[model samples]
Target: MRETLLLLGARRLQVPAIHVARKMGIRVVAIDPSPDAPGLALADCGYVYDLADKKQCLDIAERERVNGVMTLAADFPTPMAAFIAQQLKLPGISPRTALLSTNKRHMRAALSDANVPCPISISARSLDEAIHAMKSIGGPVIFKPAVSQGGRGITRLEPEESLNSIKSAYEHASNATRGDGILVEEFVDGPEYSVEALTWDGLTTVVAVTEKLTSGYPHYVEIGHSQPPTCSTYDVEQLSRTASSGVAALGIDWSASHSEIRLTCMGPRVMEIGARLGGGYINTHLVPLSTNVDIVGAAIEIALGRKPKIEISLKNKAAAIRFLVAKPGIIQSISGIEDVKNLTSFNDIDIFVNPGDRVLPLSDADGRLGYVICTGENSKSAIEAAETAKSLISIKTV
Candidate 1:
């Protein structure tokens, strides 16, 4: 009999994972808050429920008699998946680990206790506390919500900034968190990278290192990513060690983890770890393109309490994804999309906006209008192809 898997978050980002699980002969029960979510259509059964509501999702899972539950590339769903898995005694990340991974304050404490290299951070609930944190940290610091995603409500405060600046940033962070506490930490300056891994039976395997490209400014939004970063073997090993240590520190026993690390002058310091696949098409496009690892299929198997095949089938090629961002206003038209798509080097092009749709300024990851994924003989070539495709396509907004 085919086992039923409870899949959370039926957004477009999760469609690939749902399709992969169904292809593996596993029945997928997808749930999301929106009834019209695209991925829900791919599941054997669909439910309209908030993914953050653990109790409801658990009840549904129980009624369905699901073998396991899991989520991919989402924030709220990860903890919910953990809760359901624990209730059913299934294979997944521990609920305690899920909470620690979702909250920045708790995650930092755990990492610091484990002697993991990361920024010194403190949690604050008010502007006065934030000011005190800035004074204590004694350097340029970043204000982030303890619980938020996609770089939403993240602000960097300079050393010479005034109280008003702190207050504004604090307010923004608080709003994004919906009054939840905020995390103020010393800003680590350096190149940032994302590590993808899968943990099975308490053992973590570092799958790939992704070089992250962000628009450097007041708000850091990921603009592009290339797999198998051009780094020395020693650096890769160091990053892998850091990622493994972080997973161990967070107590992620059986699940996929996305760890973000910054290579600073002092050394490599972990920024944050998401208890799911790395978003931005890294798992669906880049990781497999660079490492030949079937992360989605493996995740499905892991959720079903099966040991996944972890062999690297190909490591000679590379892949990259470049996001398309538009200026603030209404999208008048898009041109040269077909031209860019016709390029043999490009793998896929996804446009999220259309003419007459309102477009916001590039402040967060949600501001992306579309993206282009490309593969090449090497990382450098793949990156070049991504850049060329983005340049070739023009989004005209007024």
Candidate 2:
């Protein structure tokens, strides 16, 4: 009999984890508010329940007699996962660690205490407090919801910009949060990178480092990601070390972590850490192609109280994912997807809309029309393949 895992959030991101878990012979029991969540159809069994309602979800977990609880590429569910595990006396990170990982103020303080390099950030719920923070940290600050995911409620405020505008940002952040405030952080100018790692039995291993592409200024919606970045071995090691240090600092074990880092002229500074799998298909598509690690399977094992084998089955190979773009308006038509699919190294693509759908301005990742995944002998080649394939797509908007 296979051990059952209660998966939180049966959306598109969690669908990959469901597939991987089922492939590994684990029975998946998924839950989401949406009865139509895609992963729900793929799981062995599922329930329509908001992941935030721990008691309701726990009732299902108990009913299923699940061996573990976990989520993928989602934030709010991480704490809920830890809660279920702790209540059931299972192997998992503490509830405190899960909550800490999601809240920016707590996460930064922990990193700072551990001497992990991170930006100067202050939490505020009022304009007066924000002004005080600005006075201390100066301008050109970034305002982010204390708890958020997928590039939501993030803003860049310039030095000359009106400080009063932060009030509106605060209101936005407060509403977006799960009962929290906002973080005013000194902007760290650098190339952004994301580290994917798995922590088991108190040991964290960095699996892959991905170079991030984003629409800069104000809302930084991620555009693309390429693994096996063109950096020296030492720098890569440093990135891994910084990420590892952050995981250790946050006491993240028995889980996979996605750490957002910025490599400034001074050094690498951790922007924030998500105590769950990286979103945007980074783990599902990019990690497997570039590093040859089935980490989605490994994460399930961790949630199942087992140490997953983390090994490099493939070396030097690279993978990349580029998002298809379009202007904000009603899409007249879409073309060239069939043509792009024929290109070498074109692994996958998904156009999110049909002709009648309206494309919104890029406020977050959802605004992205679609994406193309590709693999190659090197990072440059893989990125080129992905971008080339993407260039074939044309989304006419009015």
Candidate 3:
């Protein structure tokens, strides 16, 4: 049987990829540092290894002689995947390109050099440097880790805010860094969107554009996302074109990418790009339901050295996913999931936490315990259905 090596198999995004691979008659060798990961139970073989440990992952891949190695949703694993694929002469982005995609500073520099629309960015190795960059770039800036993902180490600073927060941001980033420093950039005021695409021979084909709604104001946690963005067709076209240009500038010939961008009054600015599927069920649920696109299968085909089958068989529909977050502490109980699941427009509901499981505040993507996906024929209806579902579910903590 053909074999595929899947890195960071602990995530929810890896689940669909593994399921799709199994249905295609491929044996999956799942690797993750967490032995108790739920996906490991379903894999044909499971190995416990740190995904960031490039040497360890590569050693296992070589020993297994896997046909292709891949990772989904996690930015840190991209470079490791690229390194292994490069060593094995398989289909993958170059290690340098993968690094650029993971590090915001490098990605912005590359995009700027290529004349692509991107936020003005500066690198800060120290607090003084960050202060200087903020002063130079003017106020209303975003301080982010050079390589952190899922908004773990991001802080948006206003002109009036003290520099004390920058130190905290720096410490948080330093705690997560291997060696790379922090990146600060001008905060673009606009609507945020995520563009999904697949590349073949350096040509990028837009898959779907998702309208992202975040917790406005102080916390920038992503509250929900929907497909077939509610923006004007012109805005959508511009976003697609800018996303394509950003991917092309990265020099990736064959791969899948999930890019986040902001549509400002000035224009569309590239936020960040990942050479993998979009996180939070964007690929598994929203894309398939709204676009009738089988992205997981296409990713597998691309990994196997074949052109991806890309086509949008459905249109004029919308799908939204809303995550349920809880206050910090242990989860006491959850109620109303069945009621929400019974709703006509609610397509699916998944709860990841048990009654006794500890829950964290909604800071980053990892803090989400579960999510509800709703669908409708229009954006308003879809958003309404999602809101209804969100209201039905109640998470209690102690």
* Per-residue lDDT over 78-172 for candidate 3, one digit per residue giving the tens place of the 0 to 100 score: 88888989999988789998888888778888889889998888888888898888889986888777887777766688867775776776676
Query: In candidate 2, what are the lDDT values of residues 278-319, reduced to their tens digit?
Result: 999899989988889998998889999999998976565799
After TM-score superposition, what is the CA distance of residue 14 in candidate 1 from its true location, in Å?
1.0
- Cα-based lDDT for every prediction: 0.89, 0.88, 0.82
User: Cα deviation of 178 in candidate 2 (Å)?
Assistant: 2.4
Model 1, 125-240: lDDT tens digits are 88889999999999999999999899898899997898788889998899888335999989999888999999999988888999999987677889999987988788888888
Candidate 1 deviates by what RMSD? 1.2
TM-score versus the correct structure, for each prediction: 0.98, 0.97, 0.95
- Which has the greatest TM-score? 1
Q: Which stretches of candidate 1 lie over 4 Å from their true place?
A: none
